[model samples]
Target: MPGSPAQAPAEPSAAVRSAAAAAWWTRWWVRVLAIFVASRVVTTVILLIFAANQGQNPWTGPKPDYFSFATIWDGLWYNIIAVSGYPSTLPTDGGHVTENAWAFMPVYPGVVNAVMFVTRLSWAPASVLVSVACGAGAALVFHRLLRRVGLSESTALFAIVLFCVAPVSPLFQVSYAESLGILLLAVALLLLVERRYGWLFPVTLVMAFTRPSGLAFALALGLHVIYRWVRRGTDPFPVRERVLSVSLTVFSGLAGLAWPAIAGLVTGSWTAYTDTELAWRAAYIGYVHLVPFAPWFQGAQWWSTVMLGIPGWVGIVALVVIVALYAVLLFSPPVRRLGPDLLFWVIAYSVYLFAVFFPQSSTFRLLLPLFPLLGVLALPRSRVYRVLMVVLFLAMQVGWIAICWGVAGADWSPP
Candidate 1:
C-alpha cells in the first residue's frame, strides 16, 4: 500500500519557463526585435488575406497582383523599368500614363534594372526579393551600427524596432530605395568609425548613387578625411583605404551635382522631380533671404498650420528635445569615444531632408529612414524613455499597417 501510494512524478512547472521568458523580455533588444518580427508577420498576413479575398494571385497576377514588385509611388515606376528594360523615355502616350513627382530617382531604378540583367527573373519576383533582402539587411546593419555607437544592447534593439515599426519601414522591405539607403548609411557610418578614409570614398560613391541626399554625407565624410590628412601630415591610412575614400569623395560630390543635370539631359527640361523644386510643392517656403531653399525651411509650410493645434505642439516639443539631445551628445563624455561619424551623418541627413523636401506631408516619408539615426543620437539612458520609444514606434507601425490595409482594397492598381 505504501509503495502504491507513491504516485508518479509531477510534471515540471511552466512557472519556471514563464520566469525565464519574462527575463528574456526584459533584455530590451530581444523584446524590440520580437515586436518588429511580429509587426511584419501581421502586415504580411493582412496582405495575404487581401490577395486571397480579391482573387489576386499571390504568386502572379497584375503588377502588384498579389504581392510582387508592384508597389505604389516609385515602386511601380522602377518595376516598369526593370520589367520592360530601361526605356530612355517612359511611354507616356500623351496623358495616358500616370506618373508622380516622387516617381523618379535613377539610382533605385538603375539598380533594379541591373538585378534584372543578372538574375533574368521576371521583374515582379526579383523586385520583391531584392526589396526583402535590402530591408532585412538595413535593419540588421542599423542594429550593429547603433551598438557600436555606445547604445545599450536594449537601446540598439529598440532602435531597430523603431526603424521596422516606423510608418515607412515596410517600404524598406518592399520595393523602395530607403532600405538600401539605410544599409549604405549604416555601412558608411561603420567605415567612418574605423577611420578607413580610403575605403569610405567608395562607400561614399554608393551612397551618392543610391539617393541624391547622400551627397551631403559625402561632403561631410570627405571633409573629415581631408581634415584627417591635414592633421596627420603624412598619409595616415592604408593605400587602398585612401583610394576608396578619395574616389568616394569625387563620386559623392560630383555624382551629387550630376543627378539634376542628368535628369535635365534626359527629359529635355530641368523640371524632372530630382531637378525641379516645384515638382510636388507643398510645405516649402522660399528662403532666398535666409536659410537657403532647404527642405525643412521649405517644409515649414506643412506643420506651420498644423502646429496651431495640440498634436503639432507635441511635434514641436519632440523637435526641441531632438535638437537639445543633439547638442548634449556633442559634449557628453560617455559617448565622446564614438567620435564624429554618427554626429555628422545625423546632421547631414537632417539638413538634407529639411533643405530639400516639401512642407505638405507631415511624416515626410522621404526622411523616415533618419528616425533610427535620430533615436540613436538621442537615446536616453533612462529606462522609462526607452520603453516610451519602443511603445511609440509600435504604435506608429500599427497605424501604418491600418493605412496600408485600407489601401489594399482600393483599385489604385499598380502601375
Candidate 2:
C-alpha cells in the first residue's frame, strides 16, 4: 500500500459541487428567508404600482409613497392607536357605536410604538418595519410547522413560498397586525404540534390581543382535548397533560374575552367591543344585534343584493357551496396529511369566522390565519402546477391590492 504511487486528492465532481451548492441554498432557514424576501419584493412592487396611481383619498394624498400607501386602510387605524391611545368614550353614529380604535388591538401598535421610540422612526416606517420583521419570523416558524407535521423539506419550503406570495401576504410588509398575529400563531401552532403545552400560554395570550382569534384557538384546543381523549387508547393522554390542555383551553377562552372586558371596564359599557366591531358591518346591514352564525348569512344576502342585484337566497346557496367546498378540502388527502392538530385549527377557525365574521372585502385578509392550508397547495409536485400557482397568486396580489387596498373614490372595499 505504501509503495503505490500517491494519488492526488480527489476533488468533488462537478455534480457533487453543484449539489452541495443546491443543498446550501435549500437549507430550510435559507430558503425561507429567500422566499420571504422575494415575496415581499413582489408584493412591494405591486403595492407601489397601486400607490403611484392612488388618488387623494381619506388616508393619503394623491400618489402617496410606499409607506403612506402601506399605512392606509387599517394601517390608519393602527397609526391612530400608535399615536393616540384608545378613546375613553367610544365614537358613535347617531345613537349607535361606530368604528374606533377599540377594534384595533394594542399589541401591534404597542410593538410599533416601541420600535418607534427605540429607533426614532415615524409610525408608517416603524409599523412597516415591525410587520416585515414579524413576517420573516412567521415564515421561519411556518416552515417548521409544516415540517413538524410530516412535510418533506422541499414541501415545507414550497409551502412557505406559497404562504409568502398569498394574496393577503401583502399584510406581511404593510402596517397591519396580521404579520405579528401570524408570527405568534405560527409559533403557537408549532408548539401545539410539538406538544409543548406550557409555552403556549403566554403566546396564546399575546396572540389573542394581536388579533381576535383567541376564541377560535380555544375552540381548537378544546377539540384537540376531545380528540386526544378519544384516541387515548393509542395516543396515551396522561392525566397531567390532560389537565394542562384543559386549563390552557379555559385560559385561552378568558384571553379571547379579555380585550372586550378591558374595553367595557374602561368605557363603562359592556358592549363596547362588540358594538365597535358591529359598526364596521353596519355599513352593509345597518344596526343589528350580534347573533351567532347570522352575520355570514346576513353578509351573503347583503353582498348578493348590493353587488349582483340578485336574490339573497342565491347568495345563501352560494355560501353553502363555499362551505361545502371547504369541508371537502378539509377531508382531502393533502389537508388530512397536515395532521389532526392543524386540521382542528382550520376547522375551528372557519367555524369562528362563520359565527362572527361579516364577509366582505376584508374576508380575504381574515382568511390569512388559515395559512396552514398552503401545505395543500404546495403538495403537488408538478412543476407546471407549482409555477402557475405562484403566478396566479402574484396576479391575485395585484387584484387584491387594486380592489381592497387601493382607495378609488368613495370606495366601500377595506383591506
Best-fitting candidate, scored by lDDT = 2
Model 2 Cα lDDT, one tens digit per residue, 290-384: 99999999988988999899999999999999999989989988789999999999999999999999999999999999999999889888899
Encode model 1's per-residue lDDT on 258-324: one tens digit a residue: 6566656666655453423443342133222224444443334336544454444455566567667
TM-score list, all predictions:
0.67, 0.94
Report the lDDT of model 2 for residue 35.
85
lDDT, candidate 1, residue 306? 49
Write down the lDDT that model 2 would get: 0.92
